[model samples]
Target: MWIVLMAESYDRLKKRAQNRRSDAEEAAKYIFDIPEDMLSDLSDDDDDNDPDFLSPEDLDDVDANTEPSDDYSVETPPSSHQQQPEPTASTGKSKKKLKVQEKFGWRKVEIKKVDLSWKGEPRQVPGILETPLKYFQKFFDDELLELIVEQSNLFALQTEGCNLCLTVEELKVFMSIILLLGVIKVPYYRMHWEAATRYPKISDKMGRQRFAKIKRFLHFNDNSKAKKSGEQGFDKLYKIRPVLGHIRSKFLEVTPEENHSIDEQMILSRGEAA
Candidate 1:
């Protein structure tokens, strides 16, 4: 009876174990079978018709054996939803520099008499009396003399009057002096001295002051005109004045021998007279 009982118990345990094994297998099949169909559907969606589809075989050329390289990169194309930047406008316009105008005038003056015998005389003919004659004779046939006269007149008009006021004849004389200096490329003071020496009637101090005033007026007028014309106003006006002053000083310093000659001649004449 005991042996039979033991055999019955063993049979029950084996049967229970077999039942558990069968349940586990069924559960595994239930889980795996559903995923298999889902996998198949995913594979079908990865065909050429799908723009985002890419196969593992396609990526096989990307060396699996080697470490990945960041040197070369793949970027997604810019989408229609993305915004781009616009260009800016240009502004670099330039203005032209102006040309300085010629300013001076001339007129024909009748000679009352010709002193032919005075040519070889110790008392030389004054430059005032000689210059026009020489110019008229040299450029008589050419238009140069007429042009000179016109320019002189224009200059007189441009710079007329004492800093206070100027008469027409005084203005003409001022213009003539400016032209003479310019032609010879001399300074205002030197030109003033020349004119004073030529015409003993003109006082030295008066001529000097006149030239200084004229220079200041010209400089101020030029700057004002440029400003009024909507041009680049004289940015260098202050600097230019100092430079012009230095130039004037240097010019006066030049030709020391010629400058001293007149003084030396006067001194020697005085000594001889004494």
Candidate 2:
């Protein structure tokens, strides 16, 4: 009886061992049969605690997919902090008001009408006989007239400020040359030699060289003259010596009535004769 009992017990123990082995083999087979994607997902979950496991691309994708919370507010860029003001009808009116205020200022001028017609020659008049105020009122607005007056006054002040260091003879020679050039209406190269020969102060060689320098200062080259002619012929017409003389006579305190008369003659000769 004891021997039979031992054999049964041994058999039972062997069967239990075999069953445990079979169960272990079945579980391993099931695990191996799982899809590669499921296995990868399980491996990723296992590596969640590891900081080095996630790649930069993976982290970027995660950040991109995540949405901001409702409670969180993003800070605006410095450039976008200020809001732009919109243009409106009220603003337009304000701009017009500002322009008017800028033009007239607080003080106003009282203008009176006067007849200026005379039987005498206009050239003999002491001052500009025509009422500049009336002319301005007719041709332009008060604002425009104010601007013109301001600019003219400024130009007068500037011209009067220059000190001419030339001797009386040199001044006479310069004026005579300018007048001759105006009368003949010839280019500087042709007239310069003749003028220099006529005037004892100017040598022929010096006159020629000075002519080139003066032309350069006046921007009388082909290209600049052509460009200026296309616009208004301003460059060709604005000779520096004549302009300086006029400005000096009109604005300078040292200039007498004789100088003014000479300037008037020069103006007439250039404008009417030339």
Candidate 3:
């Protein structure tokens, strides 16, 4: 009787152990066998807050059964954050749908070539392309030089209470020295007149002191008659207005060929060019 009772207890224990193991295995299978839609929802919930994360729709998954069309086409999916445009009543189509349906059609057309030959005169004013000085003087004539002299002398008298008596010939020499300095650059204007680095062409034509005085008193327009800054009739380039006007008049007189181009690279410095 004792042996039978012990065997019955042993069998009950074994049965309980098998039942617990079976329950555990079934629970594990239930966890792994979740529905596809439920798994997708869980994944979307996890990534909804993440902006950088791409949703399933953004991915291009071509169907294996689909065949290629004769016309090449690509449809890009809109971002998750982008709002959908409302459909218009007249067209019965949304702007996005219209954009997707838009096609670029090409058709055969006839084109004609036109002649582009020069018919105008070779030279507007027939004259020899002579010396450089003559070419320069053609633009900066005696009239322009006289105007400079008059203005400079008048400015000197007004400011210094003394006659500058600036002649056109002297003004021309002063201008020549200025142009020469641009070509043969030095650290300072005084260096050109210095004994160690004396340029005779500049120093011999005009003394350093005289050049400085002329430069100081030089004017293109009357200061008293000019409007001040913030005034009603103020001109930004008032001081150089007369000079600019004269130069512009001269520029208007010039006639170029049909294919003429003005190269402005020469005026720009290295810093400006960059």
Cα lDDT tens digits, model 1, 1-274, are 9788667865765676677643433333343444544454544444768887766666785556568588988888755445533434455685444553444467798979966443332543346655674543442222423333343444455667323343344544555665565555534345445644443333332475775554444321232233433456634454245345544665575333312233334234445454
Candidate achieving higher TM-score, 1 or 3: 3
What order do candidates take by lDDT, descending?
A: 3, 1, 2
Candidate 3 local accuracy as lDDT?
A: 0.78
Candidate number with greatest TM-score? 3
Off by over 4 Å in 1: 1-70, 73-163, 191-206, 218-274
Give, for candidate 2, the lowest lDDT window spanning 10 residues. 216-225
lDDT of each: 0.48, 0.46, 0.78
Candidate 1 matches the true fold with a TM-score of 0.20
Badly placed stretches (over 4 Å) of model 2 are 1-172, 191-206, 218-274
Better of 2 and 3 by TM-score: 3
lDDT of 2: 0.46
TM-score of 3: 0.54
Whose lDDT is greatest here? 3
Clashes of each: 11, 0, 0
Candidate 2 lDDT over residue span 94-139, tens digit each: 6422222122236677889887555443444347566854543343
